[model samples]
Target: MIDTSSFQGKKAAYYTLGCKLNFSETSTFGKMLQDIGVVAAREGEKADLCIINTCSVTDVADHKCRQAIRRMVRNNPGAFVVVTGCYAQLNPQTISCFDGVDLVLGSNEKANLLQFLSEKWSGMSSDAGRNHLHEHFSVKTKDIKTFVPSCSRGNRTRYFLKVQDGCDYFCTYCTIPYARGFSRNPTIASLVEQVEEAVADGGKEIVITGVNIGDFGKTTGESFFGLVKALDSIEGVKRYRISSLEPDLISDELIEYCGRSRSFMPHFHIPLQSGSDSVLKLMHRHYDTALFAEKVRHIKSVMPDAFIGVDVMVGCRGETPEFFEETYNFIDSLDVTQLHVFPYSERPNTSALSIPYIVDDDTKKERCHRLLELSDRKTMAFYNRFIGKEADVLLEKASYGKAMHGFTANYVRVELPVSESLPEYDNSIRKLLLGDFNHDKTALKATVI
Candidate 1:
């Protein structure tokens, strides 16, 4: 066993990049340190330890991870730096080569971070050189199988519950499976217990996050729909939003349940990496354009005002000009609210590297810009549809001396101006009328009913 007293009175700083799952995991790491008497470092205060959770979805994400590591080390000056997450799992040696990186933990090892810290906390050195990281620090991606549960509110009004982890799908041009390992998840009963705990801690909103949340039954025999049904039965959770799910895994029964359920919001986020059937075939995607469009049509058939977000990738290995045009036309016809468009980046050890006809950088930039513009138009149209409608908004705490902001059940951003007549809106649900766009046009202005 590790000694807990070694961590007492130590101040630590945390830096997290990437998805909501990474943020949820970092928050759990903070709670683990706090239990051992380590406090968070205040502004302008030097810290004794630094924890960085990184992402490796794209080459740009990897670059940002390295930048964050160096900046944290420079700011903390003699702190024990620990790096983990997808980047650390895939490229531990590259990260260890950087100056002042004390340890690089793997995906499975992140769950036992406190034990690793206890072993190194005594007589620790912050030297830039020397063999501080051992070969045993990271396990091979195939060896990772543990599922660690995390339910925490990290600087947000909504609590993120990590019910699942890892991915089994190995799409061409993707490195997530190699970085996150095979699909796995906890039992429905255990996840329900975690939700109850969050509710006990006064959590009003919960977002179900995971790498492949739709593949929730790989480790356990429970289904994702079973997990959803169980979570909706919890008493104190006023809202629940699903982060993203595969189009093939979104069953008709699940969509119907969310359409009628009391707590499940009328919001959905699905990924359509390429709208062109030929490009999707090259990427080895399970479903094609026809199925994806039908899914969108079905969602709208049940809930007309639902907010649908999509993920699109431009400039894959074999995406030609004709294929790009096909993708644009298909997306322009969808009822999606927003688009998350990103240019494809080459990653090591992926099948896409061998494909012919790679796109040029200039062409990729143009395609990304075009998709983003279409996304803006669709988002504005969706927001305008609800301008005169009444909505029940769950207000969040004010920040930056600005008016309070919140989201409706369908995930529309609403801002309420600060005034004495307004009730204490922090963490309170208020019925309001959606008005015109605010000054910057970021969110819709709202007035209390």
Candidate 2:
């Protein structure tokens, strides 16, 4: 075995990009480093090793990854850098060309990082050794064939549990299906045990994470509802939230279970890429506007206070004025809490590039702005409804301006001034009486009852 004594006293720092799923994976690897005696780099200190978890969801996302890599290398010139995740999986050589990068591991390769690092560090300390290390460091993603389970831990109150991995749905505008292989997940038994682990680690809430979470158990001969039902029985976790589910994959049984389950929270993030059936078809999304609206109505009927977040893409090939109008009007009619509006960017190697009639840049911006305005209205309306009601909020330590902040069980963002008794309540939940909106309406101001 290679001697790892040199790694024992070193410092490592991590930077993550993209979704909750990526954050969870980064946290997991950071903890693994901790286990081997490497601690996190202290504030204002350069790390001996730097890890960059990447995303390649869009063209801009790719650019951001490049920028982050360069910035990390510039700051910590001697640090060995490891670049991994979706961007690395899709385009490894591009990341490998960076000056300070010692290794580039793909999605499948990233999981077994300790072994790869051990092989590289077998002796000879200088640039010559590193150059030899670099020669054999490319771990390509032949295919993602298994689920790599992970959970987030730290000072945060909410934990992200990655129950599923990969995606089968090859949407025309998305590169996820290529970066992450087929949709796969662990059995319900495995995930329930992971939920128990998160609770034992003092997590109050758990967010189920994956590329396509709702498609869990397709290979295991189980359903998403079955997994939810299993997790609901875990005693210590206070609440659970679905990261984001494809509209069609969301079943009535799942919604109904959330309505009655004591452990599940009243929040749902369902993606409705386009409200126009024609647009949906072109995007290769599985559901239409009618089905999405029906699902929204069902959730509302069962739990009126539930927060529904929708994801929408503003522009795509063949999205004309008529189709754009259809999406806007459909969203306006829904009883949602907020909208995550994304202006579609043509990704290389995707089916969308060949589609006719590309939406102009100006049109994309206008549509994005209009949807953002609608989002603001929807978010404020959602917060307005709960005014004067008591909300149970899980507090976080991150200072929001001059005050502390947290999210209520219904997912309402609330702000309050820090108290002398605040330290005792970090990462803990407390009940508060909701007051009116704050001056800017970004979050509701609440008082402890």
Candidate 3:
């Protein structure tokens, strides 16, 4: 119904703001624009259209979105700015108030951008008239499972394939459920086919990423274990990694699948949020600290060398100093390889904002620093275990200052001396001798065989 004939020679540039899902959506949008004869360019470059996929996870996301729009307008004075994603979905009116913002498309309407743009182009006589389309293009959220795969850019050995979107859990202090809507997952067969295509395109690794990866099978009655099994069965994939998963979703079958499957990496990133049961209850998380610890113990039992990463948020409401100490000590006692510490940032319309006893900023900073220091120690210890042992590394690229750097199977950063084999070794798994303590003990330098 929309005319694309007017956009034949036009160009567009895309910018992504948040998680892997945002990147995937940006890439999909880029492909859609490209299909309609719109050339893709880098951000800050002169282009007819600038598409920005925004995020609303943190309070700073709004500022970043606005700044990006300003920068785009500065570089290309007359460019049309199309804003979509979480920030646009939740705060379209606020985003539309910006000076250079020409279109504010919500998450549901992002797919129809090209169609809308084409329709606008047919109606507008001059560039000045196109701004009116912003008001008309505003869309209400609809129930549709539009699985558009993101195009992989950059020299990434691994590609993040977003097989799912949205979240069902409305945890206090979290705005994801409101921003992304309910959980929706693609069919296992479709995902397997995507993995095959990625493997064929020379992607050495594929990361299964989503808002709530643990809630994958809840909607369709297809378990996360089933998805893992299907992806593990795919041929030509060197490695596959699962992104953030909730503690309750870490089942015995999933652990067993990782242990037995050749392609699945022995690295799991499960979010624990808080270690204190009382704090976790206040946060409205599903699982307790005991259940979470049991899950970690079980993973270690199955794959002892598995790189376990835990997510902890500090300074949530009602988290006392003693509670934080409990969290720090609990993480220190665990066999986790690393810690991803997030200093809790309160967002608008979240339950945590209403809760009393919010920790001071200084106390939150201190707690974050304490956990980061602990993380340094834990990561170094994990790296030291592989010292003097040969690790199969998928060499990525040559660093400008340091030598070639890549990741091992267990997700350790390994750097090797620059050599003739470096180019051929890129994206290929090769054996390397991991050396001891560099300037930072956490990372290990290597020499290729």
Candidate 4:
């Protein structure tokens, strides 16, 4: 344990990997540190501590965690390093074995990080890394029962709010159910307070996120649609976006209500998983392709301009060549804005690992390539259809090549010229006239009104 008495005027640098959910939790950690008078790590300065929030969605993600830990150890000498989140929860001992990791916090420990620090680091020693991280810090993953709510302030324009967490669906290929706990969420009143706090912090757009957000309030009497409806009533936020949701849980009522909502943005990112019904069944997916397509149809019928993004996984067990084509054709036929294609990776103890048909690395690469190409075509078509139209854009704080960038309600990426007046528009919503495609035709150039 390191001495907290030495923490005066110290700074911490946070490095996070994985989804918006992880960032949300990490930002909360930063806020906790600030409450204790610690500051953010500045440029060219060695941090007093470094926090790494990890992911283990795939085998590659585990390797990335190892590489990140080694980089932190090598670059930031004498800094106390802490590794936590899904990867840490899934394999605490493996992460604890890393030479520089001072603490390995599991799911529940990460939520209440301040208490852990106060108890474990109340001045045992500043030379904490010499001893095993397990000797001073450890937590069991199963003891994590309650939910830990988080809202990500990744920037001023967009805040990723985690209203729900965990998953009840034990899909064959997914380890999310084990890594996170059973599906649960904060009460409607608690979530409304979080949204209000986000808006108070000058947040313009709030992206709703979680591990099965559609399955919200499983332990409570409320519902996901009810949660969104309450958020729609909030006055300060300009727009909101729902993250990846299951198709079956996306009711027609939610789609229709959001279509007419003043605050809800016209963008839906629904995970179809696969277009082949047989493959979906093999993976123990809840909904079939027909249901998924019907959900898309409902959204398109209510809001034709709405941007629909689909998440497709390729190269899972039993997905033969014909099955691949079925998925390709089914997605191609859907009126979606874009595709997020992922190549399936085997996880330990998953049911998919026992299945006989194992896709080769070369085959997985090829299938991933095919879906990515299809995504490029779909995105170009979607953007072209919106050309010369007008939409509201919440100008973000990032830019490239002397131009500012923002996103439309339907998730269109738009760029505008950066000038002396651009700072005034930052984090503010502006009426943008989507005009022409830029050179190489990746993003649309817009004129701010």
Candidate 5:
């Protein structure tokens, strides 16, 4: 073990991969290390310690984790490489095999990272027995009961407040349940406190994020609607956004409340993996296409200008050209603002991988391109409807091209002319006059009122 007495004022760098929950947990861990006088350092800069928070969402995640570790070791050969999170919990042995990975802490052990480091550095020789991270590691999920305020690095106009963790759905194509374990949530009172704290910290908007946010409070008996109502009562928070939610969980009360809630933003992201009922059944998704369409209609009936984002996974097992066309047509017929299209990736131990009629890589690529083209059209049409209208934009920082950017309550991306008077952080809002979409509809440039 390296001696802690000699490590005072040492530098540390952290790299996080995966969902908002992982980002929040990394921020919390960063703060814990900071309290012990470990200063946060840049990625390429030499540091005494490096912590990598990993993900296991897709096959790409594994490749990315290994690449990141190799790069970090190359940059800081002397740094103690510590790996943690879902990937580490699921495949500790694989990560432990890396040459520079001096320590591997699983989910539960992550909270005790500082203690582990101290013990390792205090007169503990780097013997073969002490160096075997796989033998000393433990993986277990902690019972989360409190909300943590975490925002992305750099100047983020919006922050993601992790209100829930873990999933119980066990969908055929998902390994999130096994990687994250059972569902858990912070108490309503705790979440409200965190929201207030975020607002106090100058966050204009908060997106309630989680692994399976729809299943929130199932163990505590509090409904998602109840959480929304409580959050609405909190003053100073300008906008509240719900991350991706299940269609069946979108209740009538929640839809109506969103229509009238002053704090709730007019945006919703719902996942609809497939439109074919047979495919959905085999995928183990709870709701069918009709039910999903009904939920979208209900939300639109109340808030016509609401921005609806849909998640579609194409070219999964059993997804023939005909089956895919049905999904494409359903999405085309919907009044969605945008689409998050993902080509299905086979995951280990997933039922979908073992199913027959696996889609070829070429087919998946073609389907992905088709849906993306449709998404561009839908997004352009959605943005066109608001052209020449005035939107209350929470002004953020100047971008790479010296263009100032922000977002409206409806979640439209707006870029405004750079001005000295515009607010830099959470301190300013501008009444932006919307303009025509640029050649690429990814961002809409606007004029400041």
Candidate 6:
């Protein structure tokens, strides 16, 4: 009942703000537009349409989403602007009120974006249709059940495969479950097919991403381990990295399997929101400090040279001075490669609000700075251990200054000089001898082996 004629020769500009999953979904939207003969707008060129995918993890993220939507509208004159993702799903009416926004879609509506656009475009010429179609779009969180599949590179050498969507954990300070809905995922067979397609398209490395990837089998009867086994069997993939996993869900069997697997790298990212067991309990986290420490020890025991990244949130409700000290000391004792430190941002309608203690903005900022400084030391220490050693690195296409960058199998950043004698090695795995730190000390300088 819709005409595809209108879509021909259209150019769209996309803006995504958030996690790897958002970027993957945006790439899927780009492909959908391409299927209709709509290409991406070139730099400095005005677009006929603009799609902005948003995030609402924190109030700061919500502010950024609003700013992005406004900037896109201002840049693309006369463009039909569409907004979707977490921010839109949670606060649809607020975004709909924005002056230049044409349409707003939530998580439930995101998968059927093309269909929604068709329905809206069919009647835009008439005043009645324009008025009726110019509202926000989203179903209740409970109604969001569909698991849309996404496997995309998104202008990167490493393809991000979305193995799962949504989450079931309703941690007191978290709003992800409310925005993304209960946990769900596609069948293992379908995911394997996606991986095969990515490989055929020249993808060498894949980072399995999700809201909670370890809880992958919520919809299907398949376990995360089963999915891992299925993906490992695929050919052409040189490296595989599990983006993030909960400590409790990271079974010892899985750790040992990854250690012995052919493709899975010696890198792990696990979140330990607060190192204080009391604070973790207050945050409604599933795992305790003892269990988290045990997991870290187990990982180091099996993969001695592995890179372990931990996520630490500071100054949440009920986190007193003593608690913050507990967190800092605990992290200092761990052999983590780096820390991803976040200052707590209070979300609406959450159990965290009921807690009596509150951390002032200045205190939160101070705690974040302290943790980040600690992170720098830990990261530098990890990089120093690999100096003068040869490791296989997957060269990425991105460049910084006069240097090119790539990541080793253990997730160590390596910098190579841009020399006339050197051949182009983008997207190719090559062995490199790690040397001293780069000019900025952000990565290890390397020479091709």
lDDT (Cα, tens digit) per residue for candidate 2, span 1-449:
53577678788878899988888999988887788777999877888788899999988999999999988887776777888888988888777878778888887778778777777642324242344234223333345775567878645678888988888889999988777788888888888887788787788888888999888888899988888888888898888888898888889888898899898888999999898999999998888899999999999999999999999998899798999999999999999999999999998889998899899989999999999999999998889899999988887876534566788888999887655227666778888888898888888888887
Please report, in order, the local distance difference test score of every candidate based on alpha carbons: 0.89, 0.83, 0.79, 0.83, 0.79, 0.89
Model 1 residue 298 CA deviation (Å) reads 0.6
lDDT of 5: 0.79
Please list the Cα RMSD from the true structure of every candidate, rounded to 1 decimal place: 1.7, 2.2, 2.4, 2.3, 3.2, 2.2
Give lDDT tens digits, candidate 3, residues 1-449: 65667777677777789877788778767767777777876654578778788898877787898888778766765677788888888888877777777788776677677776875553343363334344423444345344445535334577878867777778997887777777778778878887788888888788888888877875678977889888888889889889888998788888887898899999999999888888998889999988988999999999999999988999999999888888887887899988888888888889988888889999989999989999988888888899999999988866554466778989998877655345667788889888886665546888876
* TM-score of candidate 6 relative to the true fold: 0.96
lDDT of 4 by residue, 1-449 (tens): 43456456777888889888988888988987886767998876777678899898999888998898878776777677788888888888878878877788877677767767667553434353455354223444355676777776875578888888888889999877777777788889888898899888888788999989999878788999999999989989888899888988999889889989998888999998899998999999999998998999999999998999989898999999999999999999999988888899899889888889888989999999999999999999999988999988878765533777888888899888665227678898789889888887777898866
Q: lDDT value for candidate 6? A: 0.89
Q: Model 5, poorest ten-residue lDDT window? A: 126-135
Model 3 per-residue lDDT at 139: 45
Give the CA lDDT, 0 to 100, for residue 66 in model 6. 89
- Give the range of the ten consecutive residues with the poorest summed lDDT in model 6: 123-132
lDDT of 4: 0.83
Error (Å) of candidate 2 at residue 228 is 0.5
Residue-level lDDT for 57 in candidate 6: 88
lDDT winner, 4 or 6: 6
Window of ten residues with lowest summed lDDT in model 2: 132-141
lDDT of 3 at 124: 42
Better of 3 and 4 by TM-score: 4
